[model samples]
Every structure is written in C-alpha cells, then in structure tokens.
Target: MTPEAPPTTPTQAVEIVRSRYAQPKLPDGTPAELKVHEFDIGYLVFAVFPPRTDAAGRPQPSPPGGAKIVVSKETGETVTVPNYPTEKAIALYRKNVERNA
Candidate 1:
C-alpha cells in the first residue's frame, strides 16, 4: 500500500468543501456539517464559523466563539451541528435550502 493522489482540480476541492460545509440531515433527523476526505496526519481542514456570544461574553448554545466546525476529512461525521427534531424537519430543511438555492 502507498499514498493516494490528492485532489488536483480546484473545482473538485471546492465541491468537496461545499458538500462538507452543507451536509444534509441524517436519517435520524440530525443535521451535520461534515466532509469526507483522505486523511493526512500532517494536514487538516478547519471550517470556522462566527462566534455565538452574548453580552456577557459567554459562549451560547449556538455555534461557539469564533466557532470552527473542525471535522475529519477522512470520515464524514461530526457533533457540532444541530440534531433535527424529526425526519419531517430534516426534509423541510433540505427542501427549503434547495428551493432557495
């Protein structure tokens, strides 16, 4: 076994990033922002989100302080995203995003 080729095209990289940033909700009605990529121990991808802070300068339930939704590119899974209340909710969310897009 040996190393595999990395994504060479900008379009491919962009698509990967986009898909990971906006993953569809799970079957159990859980929303996730994950990207699947080949793992490289020396390299990492960081998906940074704006901080969710209050007047008290404390972290809120939403996102985080300069939240970075760091995920394993090799595995499409994470825990920062919200869990949908139901399948209907997931469907509705996807539908709305698609329609708006």
Candidate 2:
C-alpha cells in the first residue's frame, strides 16, 4: 500500500496536537516553556507546566526528571513510553512523522 502525503505545514501538526493535548482527561496546561517539540522518535510531545502565580504569569522553573520514563510493565519487560492513552492521537502523530522519517 502507498503512504499518503505528510503535513505540508507546521499548522497541521500543531492543530492536531493541540486538540489532543487539551482534552479534559489529560491535564489542562501548557509547558513552562510552552513549546510543542517533535520527538526524535517522530511524535510531538508537550508538557503542561505547573501553574505560575507570579506577576508575569510565567511558570516557575522546574526539574525535568519526568521527561522520560523507564520501568518494567506487568509483562516484566521495560519500555520507554507507557501504554497508549490516546490511540487516535498517537496514530495521527505517527502518520505525520513517518513522512519525514
């Protein structure tokens, strides 16, 4: 089967991620830096930075120990990313990345 075209502009990727990341179940927030970065593995990841109360409304500095995780699952095998939370969101991101990779 032939693969379809990837996103022609960043807007498509951004819009796709924005909708998924803003869902009610997951947290409602933006990264402290408020940036959506493409992962080396080809998926977009963003952080919902802790809220800021300072005059500027910028989130305070935070340590990024949670940026990646390494643990054994119930299968007793280790994985970098945990099980899928949003299958559709993940599939969309993967489809876009495959074009570039």
In the order shown, what is each candidate's alpha-carbon RMSD? 14.2, 12.2
Deviation of model 2 at 71, angstroms: 24
Give lDDT tens digits, candidate 2, residues 12-63.
Answer: 4444444434432224442333233333333333445545455788667543
For each candidate, what is the lDDT? 0.38, 0.36
Model 2 CA deviation exceeding 4 Å by range: 1-5, 23-60, 65-101
By summed lDDT, the worst window of 10 consecutive residues in model 1 runs over: 36-45
TM-score, cand. 2: 0.28
Work out how many backbone clashes candidate 2 has: 0
- On lDDT, the candidate that comes out on top is 1
